[model samples]
Target: MQPDWALLLLVANVSTLTVCMVLKLPQIITVIAAKNARGLSVRSLLLELTGFLVFLTYQTYYEYPLITYLEYPVLIVQDAILLMCVLFYNGNIGTALPYTVLFILCWRLITIHRLIIDLAMNLSTFISALSKFAQLQSLWKTCDSGQVSALTWGFAIYTICARIFTTLMTTQDTAVLFRYAVIGVLNTWVFATIIYYRKAGKRKD
Candidate 1:
């Protein structure tokens, strides 16, 4: 790749990922302003946080490029705030504070063997994908798509797809490729669910 073209690709990738991260802002705003988390899944948020944490650990251990892993901490913090909102809205602050402490403690205690960390990173990604399913199930049962920001999911799909493409161009690392593919599929499903439920609700009106 030419230097200019490579820089363009780098810029495009980072810009798209930034948009994905920014998309969460609306959700955070909605949750706070509405003071309700009707359709949001705390489990899903926590699972996402765990996945990011593990990925962060993996990247730091392996000394990956900053661009590749820079967003993990941002995402972890965003999810943590969202989790706090979920807890507060549900009147579970006592539980939330202790859980936060425990999370920090557990993160500190984890031993960082390369093989173990790699396995855990993959496992956490799988668990995050499952968590998306659980979140979709919640939306289905409630028929409430309000808690999920379609914009966020849409940008997520874009980000994951872009990452997959970038990975293919840069390195054919099967693990990275598979992880993003799974996440992309999951995000697409969630976005579809949001549209389906939104249309269903409107038709009922």
Candidate 2:
């Protein structure tokens, strides 16, 4: 049977936005329940937040359609909350103030120079990848999922796939498409690692 491409694209786009609304909730809940940020990487969360802000700024600067980048604000807010949870659990909550100031400065500076936005857009993917790798390293070193929710990473992979589909159908910007592609792979890797370690823990009990 031939696929209904239009319906599929619509579904993908809508699902991507909807899923992103709650993408980080699982991790937040996990950290709270575990009462610690073990196996969660502060570096990963910081990089992820930076990448989100940069990408959001780029799309906004270019005046992209609201639906196209609507989910970013939600994701950014959720990530900031999660980062605070990580810091709070690690007894470094005071440091969040400095990071907040830094984010504000970067947000403004990226807009002052047009060339800066373009540079940020290009570097966004690399920064995001490093975030995922940072998480993976944390998991590998500890051999525990701990406060890193597999559910969150799994949802992230699903959303990335949906975004990839919609990006292909519409804008087809190579940079945006490539960003989703790389992050999708890394999300899957992180999800798989979390699951593997969870199962390993279960086996030991």
Candidate 3:
């Protein structure tokens, strides 16, 4: 018999969380060792942070598991530390335009929607899945390009498995199809970019 879908999703989320946590260690190391954010993209990290916050708001307004709120923040903390190490290399953090604007807009626009805020808790699952997808894509791109070092692809692969599992777990409702599309595009872009870099022999700074 097939396992229960909800159970599968829980298992997948837990497993992905584990892998994400483990993969995160090396990012810390890279920051400390290199003391520069050479290979990392500030825009990507900023986008991820904003995405998670939006999801977190949705979860809280709807009253979903508090844990979902924690996940993205945890990832953000790691990225912030990593950003600190690499900040000087990028010159002013202000140079990251994508990160700045989206992060702010997502928060402001969503917060203003009383309906969205009130219904936030119900959207927790989608938010969690979306944030996870974004972060995983960012990390995979970083690892594939040698920006984050290769000691952690195992973790990344595990995270991808988690995303695949999450996609399976979520119901295929109309609005969600768009969200899934976003995830799919991100996955494709990250993988294709990696392939492009490898073929072109563009060494990561």
Candidate 4:
């Protein structure tokens, strides 16, 4: 690939990932404004936070390209905030602060050793997939699609799609490609569920 083309793809991937990171803002705002987490799943948020934190730690250990994983911290914070809000609304304020503190502390402490970080990274990847499935289960149980932000999932799908293409063109890293491809499929399922439930809810009205 031409140097300019490679640069363009890099920029595009970064931009898409950044947008994905911020896409949760709408849902965050909705939760804050409502003072309740009716449709939100705490389990899902925790899983997301774990995944992001692990990825961040793993990258820090390996010294991978920061731009590629820079959104991890943003996502970690976003999910933490959302989870705190959920706990607060549910009248578990006492547990919220301590839990959040402990979670952050644990992530920080775990980063001190490479061996642990390696294992954690693998575990985090598995948990991330589980988290998505948990979210899907939550949606199925509640039958409420409005709780999760469709835009976030949509942007996720876009980001992963862009990432797969960019990886193929730039690095041809099979591991990265496979990871994003799986994530893309998972995000697609979540996005489709959101649309399905939203339509179902409307039909009942």
Candidate 5:
């Protein structure tokens, strides 16, 4: 007998959460090891922040099924925590930046109306894509210089696999496909960087 679709989706949601959580380990390690974010890009982390908030808003507004509802919010919280660590490493704690206020306001407003939530999710997706693109460029530079973090590469590979799974499992033509396309690009860029770096040695700037 075929298994229940709902049950399958539940499992998928759990898998997504597990993947995202595991992927964050590299960032966590970076924060711990560097003792400072001297080489890290805050813009990338901020982009992640936007993506996560949008994901949370979209899921909440739609009242998406059990595991998904839980998964989205948890992922958002996880990103928030990881970003905080990045900020701490950057020594930007206690600063009254306008972005911080804007993020907070956006977060609160997302929970206010469905339309607003939809807008937030759309914006978040855009920001996340831009952030990942930036990360891809950064990784390429590091790989060329033989200075890339293995941890970052590892997490990126994991993220790519997860995106593949997500793209396959989700229905075709859904709005979520747009997000998957962004992830697909992210995966392709990382994979290319890894392959090129392994074979070409370090490229001179």
Candidate 6:
């Protein structure tokens, strides 16, 4: 990478990581405040968490630059906590144990073969996309934003854009780039849906 591109990449990664550090805090707060997960889709969170884990493993397996994927760990932690909060609010905390074990197993198995990670990385895009769709579906059905935080979704959009740029500068892996591009769009859609529902709810009230 050229020095200028390298510098931009570093900045993008740092900026992305900075946002991710608190990306899910808003949603967690919203959930706690409402004491409900009404408009939130647990499946969406699970798929998103899985995608993060698999993508991080794929990037590490290929020895991608640490800067390029550093946000994944932060995101994983945030999403995991958010997931637990959602489950707890929804009265399904017991289910977290199985999901946790499954994720651990899959994380360990994903790197066992190069092809597995490659295939997983691609499928993760679909899974992650489905996550957004699930959230959209929930929002549509509930017609309420409930505890869904517009701020968190907005932060997600920013991180996705940053990753898209850094991936282009660094690894430029098509799978990685495509993942960011698709999720960026999906995440935005989910964000917009949340905003729409929230506004509609406010107007109704």
Report the CA-based lDDT of candidate 6 relative to the real structure.
0.90
Considering TM-score, which of the candidate structures 3 and 4 is the better prediction for this target? 4
RMSD (CA, Å), each prediction? 1.8, 2.0, 6.4, 2.2, 4.0, 1.2
lDDT tens digits by residue: candidate 2, 1-205: 1379878877877888889989999889989988899999999999999999999999889887777788999999999999999999999999999999999999999998889898998899999999999999999999988777888998999988888877777778898998999999999999999999999999999
Candidate 1 colliding pairs: none
Candidate 4 global TM-score: 0.87
Deviation (Å) of 148 in candidate 3: 4.3
Off by over 4 Å in 6: 1-4
Residue pairs with backbone atoms closer than 3 Å in model 2 (clashes): none
**TM-score between candidate 2 and the true structure:** 0.95
The residue pairs found clashing in candidate 3 are 36-86, 37-86, 58-120, 61-121, 62-120, 62-121, 63-121
Winner on lDDT between 1 and 3 is: 1
Per-structure clash totals for the candidates = 0, 0, 7, 0, 0, 0
The digit string of per-residue lDDT tens for model 3 on 1-205 reads 2578667777777876766665667866866676665546555555445545665565565564543334556665665556555565567756556555756776777788778654543364455445445545555655545454444434554565566546445532333344445555554555555555555565544
lDDT score of residue 142 within candidate 4: 90
Query: Which regions in candidate 3 have their CA more than 4 angstroms from the true location?
Result: 1-7, 66-70, 93-109, 115-164, 167-177, 195-205
Candidate 4 backbone collisions, by pair: none
lDDT at position 4, candidate 1 = 84
**Per-residue CA lDDT of candidate 6, range 24-103, in tens?**
99988888887888889999999999989989999889999897878889989989998999999888999999999999
Error of 4 at 166 (Å): 4.0
99-166 per-residue lDDT for model 1 (tens digits): 77867775664444666877887787797798798888889889879767888788788878777777
**Pairs in steric clash, model 6:** none
The TM-score that candidate 1 achieves is 0.91
> What are the TM-scores, per candidate, against the unseen true structure?
0.91, 0.95, 0.60, 0.87, 0.72, 0.96
Off by over 4 Å in 1: 109-111
Q: Write the per-residue lDDT of candidate 4 for residues 1-205, one digit (tens) a residue.
A: 7889878888876786678678688878887887777767778778878777777777667776666666767777778777878888878768876767877898987787888887787777677888888889989989998557787788778877877777676557555566676777888998999899999999999
